[model samples]
Target: MLTKTKAYALKGLEGQAVEIEVDLTPGVPAMEMVGLPDAVVKESKDRVRSAIINSGFDYPIKRITINFAPAETKKEGAIFDLPVAIGILSAYDQIPTNCQDGYVLLGELSLDGSLRKINGLMAILISGLQNGYKKYIVPKENQAEASFVDGIEVYPASNLSEVVNHLSNVSPIPRLETKKFNGKNETSKYGVDFADVKGQLKAKRALEIAVAGGHNVLMVGPPGAGKTMLAKCVLTIMPDLSFEEAVEVTKIHSVAGVLDASQGIVTSRPFRSPHHSITVPALIGGDRRAKPGEVSLAHNGVLFLDEVPEYGRTVLDSLRQPLEDGVVTISRVLQTVEYPACFTLIGSMNPCPCGNYGSKNKECTCSPSQIRNYIGRISGPFLDRIDIQIEVDGISFGEFKDKASGEPSEKIRERVVKVREIERERFKGSKTRTNSEMTNEDIKKYCEVDRESQNLLELSFAKLGLSARAGFRILRVARTIADLEGSDSIKVEHIAEAIQYRSLDKKYWK
Candidate 1:
C-alpha cells in the first residue's frame, strides 16, 4: 500500500512544500527515510516508530519506505515526524487514506506519542495558505502562534492518539479560532524611562531627531556620561509597530526559536543589544543551519552596539552591506537564504582609551597615537553610514543632585508620532517609511532645498571635505529636521544642524 501526506519546509523566511510518501511491502520489518534529510529529519524514523506503538496503534511489520519528494532539496528539522507517522498508519489501513488529504500535518512526536512545539510554524502555515492549502494539524503548544493566521482551519492536537482519532472520526479535534492582530497592547513598557536621565540636552535633541527619522546615531563620551542609558530610552519614544511589521518580526523570531510561546505575536519594536566581541557569523547570521543573526533579529527595530570601537574590525565592517541593502544573504553549498535586516543602529563609544580625551574636568592621559588608533578601530566607511554623531559630556555634581528630570519619553514620542504621520502622507504609495530610507530619486523629489540651503551645503561640502555619501546623508537628516518642525521645505538652519552631525569624524577619527 502507498500513502502520501503533505508537509512544509523552510529556507530562511520562505517555505517550500514537501510531500511525504510512505510505501509498505511484505518483507523484513524495517524503515528507511530518504530524500536528502539532515540529522534531525533522518532521526525522525526512530521517533515515529516509538510514537506509533505507544499511541496504541499496531506497528507495521512490513518493510516501510518513506520518501520526501523533491529529492534534491535538503530537509532540516524534526517537523516531519507527525506526517511520516500518519502516512504509515494510513498505508496500513489503520486510518482511511482519504482523511489525511487536504490537510497539512506538521509537528514533532515524542517517544511517548505526545506532540511537541516546533519552530517556524507560522511561516509554514502562511506558505501553505498562499499555495491554496488550508486545513492543518499542528501541535497544541503551537495553537497560540496559529491563531494569529486567518483563513485556515487549524486543528491543534495534543498527542498522536488525538490525531489518529480525529482522522478516524472517533473523537474530532476542535479547530482554533482566528485571532486578530492587536498592535495597541503589544507595545512593551520598559522600566527605564527617558525622564530618568539628567542633563545632556544636546544629546537628547540628537536622539529625538534620530528616532524621528529612523536614522543611525553614534555617541562619543566619557564612561559615566549616560550614553547607554540614552540608547535604552530611544525605544520608549519609538513609534509602535504596525500589524504588518509585527507579523514580519514574529516570523523571524519564530524561525529563530526565540519567540515567547505565551505571547503569540511580537507587539513592540525589538531592541537587540549584542556584545561587542560577537563573531561575524553570530552577528550577521550563519551556523550549521544558517539561522538569522542579531541583525535580522533586530529587524523593524533598533540594533544597539555599546562601545562601538571595542568590536573587531571585521565585525564592524560586515555591517556595511546589510546597513546599505537592508538585508543579509547567507549562502551555503546547498542553498542560499536572505533575511531582513532593516533596523536603526545606535552605537556608543568613549573618547579614547582613558575615556577623557575631550573632558572638561579631567586631563587626557593617553598619548596621541593611542587615541588615534582607538578611534581608527571604526573604519571610515562604517562611520560614514552613521547619520548623527554627538559628543556627550559628564554632568556636573549639582546637575545630578537637582530635583528636576528631563523631558519624558511620552512627550517626545508624541512629536515623533506626528512626524511619522506626516511622512506616511508623503510616501503613501512607496516602500519608505522614514527619511533615512529615501533613495536618490526620493531625495530629488521630496528632499528639495531652498537656494540658501543649497549654497550652504555646497560650501560645507567643499570646506569639510565630505564625500558624496555624506552630502546625501546631510540632505536626508535636514529633510527629517524639516519634517519635525512641520516645514514645507528644507531651510538654511536645517542644513546647518545636519552639517554639524557630519563633522565629528574630523574631531575624533582624524
Candidate 2:
C-alpha cells in the first residue's frame, strides 16, 4: 500500500510544500528513508516506530520506505516526524488514508507518542495559507500562535493517538478558536521612556527624526552622556505597527525560532543591540542552516550599537550592503535564502580615546592621532550610510538637577505617527515607505528644494568636502524635516538642520 501526507518545510521566511510518501510492502522488516532529508529526518524512523507502538497501534514488521518528496530541497528539523508516522499508519489502514488529503501535518513525536512543539510552525502555517493551503494539524503546544493565523482550520493535537482519533472520527479534535491580533503586543512591555532621560534635547530630537523617516543615526558623545538611553527610547517614539507590517515582522521572528509561543503575533517593533565582538556571519545572517541573524531579527525596528567605534571594522563594514538594500541574502552550495533587514541603525560612540574630545566642561586628553585612529575603525562608507550624525554633550549640573522631565515619548510618538501616515499616503501602492529608502529617482521626484536650500546643500558639499551620496542623504533628511513641520517644500531651516547632522563627519573623522 502507498500513502501520501502533506507537510511544509521552511524556505527562508516562506513555506514550501513537501509531500511525505510512505510505502509498505511484504518483505524483510526494514525501514528506509529517501529524498534530500537531513540527519534529523533520517533519525525520525526510530521515533516514529516507537511512537506508533507506544500509542497502542501495530508497528508493521515489513519493508517500509518514506520519502520527503521533491528530493532536492534540504530538509532539516524534526517537523517531518508526525507526517512520516501518519503516512506509515495509513499504509496499515489504521487510519483513513484520505483523512490528511487537505491538511498540513507538523509536529515532532516523542517515543512516548506525545507531540512536542516545533520551531517555525508559524512561518510554515502562514506560508501555507498564502500558497492556498488553509488547513493544518499543528502541535497543541503551538495552538496560541496558530490561532492568530486567520482563515486556517488548525487542529491542535496532543499526541499521536489523539491525532489518529481525530482522523478516524472516533474523537475529533476541536479546531482552535482564532484570536484577534491587537496592535499592541502584550508579551514585551517596555518601561523605559524618553521622560526618564535627563537631558540631551538635540540627541532626542535626532532620534525622533530617525524613527520618523526610518533613517540611520550615529551619536558622538562623552561617557554617560545619555546616548544609550536615547537609543533605547527610540522605540517609544516609533509609530505603531500595521497589521501587514506586523505579519512580516512576526514571520521573520517565527522562522528565527524566537517567536513567543504564548503570544499570537509580534506587535511591538524590534530592538537588536549586538555586541561589538559579533562576527560577520552572525550579524549578517549565515550558518549551516542559514538562519536569520541580528539584522534580519531587527526587521522593521532599531539595530543599536553602543560604543560603535569599539566594534570590529569588518563586522561594521559588513552591514553596508544590508543597510543599502534592506535585505540580506545568504547563499549556500545548494540553496539561497534571503531575510528582510529593513532596520534603523542607531550607534553611539565617544569623541576620542579619553571620551572627552569635544566635551564642553571637560578638556580633551587624547592626541589627534589617537582620535583619528579610533574614529577610523568606523569606515567612511559606513558613516556615509548614516543619515543623522549628531553630537551628544553631557548634561550641565543645573540641567541635571532641575527636576523637570523632558517631553514624554507618547507625545513624540504622535508626531511620528502623523509623519508616517504622510509617507504611507505618498508611497501608497509602492515599496518606498520611508525617506531613507528613496532612490535617486525618488529624491528628484519628491525631495526638491528651493534655491536657498539648494545653495546650502551645494555649499556643504564644497566646503565640507562631502560626497555626492552625502548630498542625497542631506536631502532625504531635509525632506523628513519638512514633513515634520507640515511644510510642502524643503525649507532652508530644514536644509540647515539636515546639514548640521553631517557636520560631525568633518568634525571627528577629519
Clashing pairs for model 2 are none
lDDT tens digits, residue span 195-256, model 2: 88887788888888988898999999899888888888888888777787788888888777
State TM-scores per candidate.
0.97, 0.97
For candidate 1, what is the total of clashing residue pairs? 0
Q: What lDDT does each candidate get? A: 0.88, 0.87
The candidate that achieves the highest lDDT relative to the unseen native structure = 1
lDDT of 2: 0.87
